[model samples]
Target: MLYAGTRHRDYTLRVPLAGDLVDAQEAHPQGLVRLVALDLYRRQLLQLGEIPAEAITLELLRSELTEIDMAELERADAELGKRFAPPRPGSSTGAASSTPSSVTATPSPTSGA
Candidate 1:
């Protein structure tokens, strides 16, 4: 598990491991540290026949998280949701609408009618 923090941005990435810890000594010393860490973690997981890489994502990580880390993660997720949730249709405060408005249309007249 890895926790990454950014200014005004909350992003969580989680990868499940079922095997030995991966050695990161051979990873690149500079640039793309997060991707490298993920690759290393994934390699270790694969060696142990754990979950697939495709199963990992920010959303899944937020859900499966546990412990003190979970509290922090949830807070970050809530913040992110507030920041990125779609704007409501008619709410003045930008809050999401609970019920969507129904749409009704009258039938159009035909040319041969």
Candidate 2:
């Protein structure tokens, strides 16, 4: 339920309150603020306006975390890492690629009889 906005004045990102988010809240109280930075890279929830992570209040987190959907939280956690994943080759858009192509392998030659 917690959200953020970019300085560009384009959109806002909604924080999906999943297990990790709750765990982070319990672990350090201010941990969710860090995750907010990650969410910015992912462009996860673009709606609110433009706000900085340091400005995101813990009180809001406490009030809103429970309201998040359980299923969405699971999805958000699973997809979190994808935010930093590299873009596909020949892709012009800066958006994250649905297809993962971070690595490629080459076959080695073998001796023939």
Candidate 3:
């Protein structure tokens, strides 16, 4: 299912997997959606060989992701049975977040203590 993209699509819009988080952590280091986009498109970019990956900044990709029309993308997300999420870069409040906000960790007692 297509989760995010625009009319003239720049990257593959396939559903992002949970494993993507681990992969994205090493490289993209951006929000899930933007990381997903970069994870999908970075190597294949016609510009990648010309410029090092480090040279590409989050703002550059964010500019591309910010243009996606949320109305259609959000509808597609629902159709795919995905929870609502804003694909806008740096947003992780909803489904875009791999970890639920409701989760709280209680401190575990240390064996040494």
Candidate 4:
């Protein structure tokens, strides 16, 4: 999911685990692997000091977890995700588009009367 920060910049944070991570395995064949994966993700986030310990519970961690602590966490996560994940399809990689519309274009210079 993408988060907009205080600076009004859009940042994307991608959770790495794929749907196959939840596939039934001999050790954990009940399809609980996704839960385990989420736990690990939450622990990693906590280790990074992103979300507080109180926010690390299974319920809170499993649910959509954009909390008050997410501003900085989202920023950091976005940076990390950018470094790790491939650029999203059709996403701009360079500086954000700052071009003004044609309606706001400056008038061209003309010869003095």
Per-prediction TM-score to the true structure, in the order listed: 0.25, 0.27, 0.29, 0.28
Residue 50's lDDT within candidate 1 is: 35
lDDT of 2 by residue, 1-113 (tens): 33442222232333344554555445565645645433332334333234454544445434343322323333443454455456679878666558865221111122100
lDDT pick, better of 1 and 4: 4
How close to the true structure is residue 96 of candidate 3, measured as C-alpha lDDT? 48
Q: Which lDDT values do the candidates have, in the order given?
A: 0.36, 0.39, 0.38, 0.40
Q: Which lDDT value does model 4 have at 17?
A: 41
By lDDT, the better pick of 1 and 3 is 3
- The worst-scoring run of ten residues by lDDT in candidate 1 lies at 104-113
lDDT of 3 by residue, 35-85 (tens): 555554333233221234464445555454333332333333344334334
Of candidates 4 and 2, the better by lDDT: 4
- Deviation of model 1 at 21, angstroms: 23
After superposing candidate 4 on the true structure, give the runs of residues whose Cα lies further than 4 Å from its correct spot: 1-15, 19-55, 59-66, 87-113
**Model 3, clash count?**
0
Cα displacement (Å) at residue 54, model 3:
14
Ten residues in sequence with the least summed lDDT for candidate 3 = 104-113
Q: Which is the leading candidate under lDDT?
A: 4
Highest TM-score model number: 3
Which is superior by TM-score, 3 or 4? 3
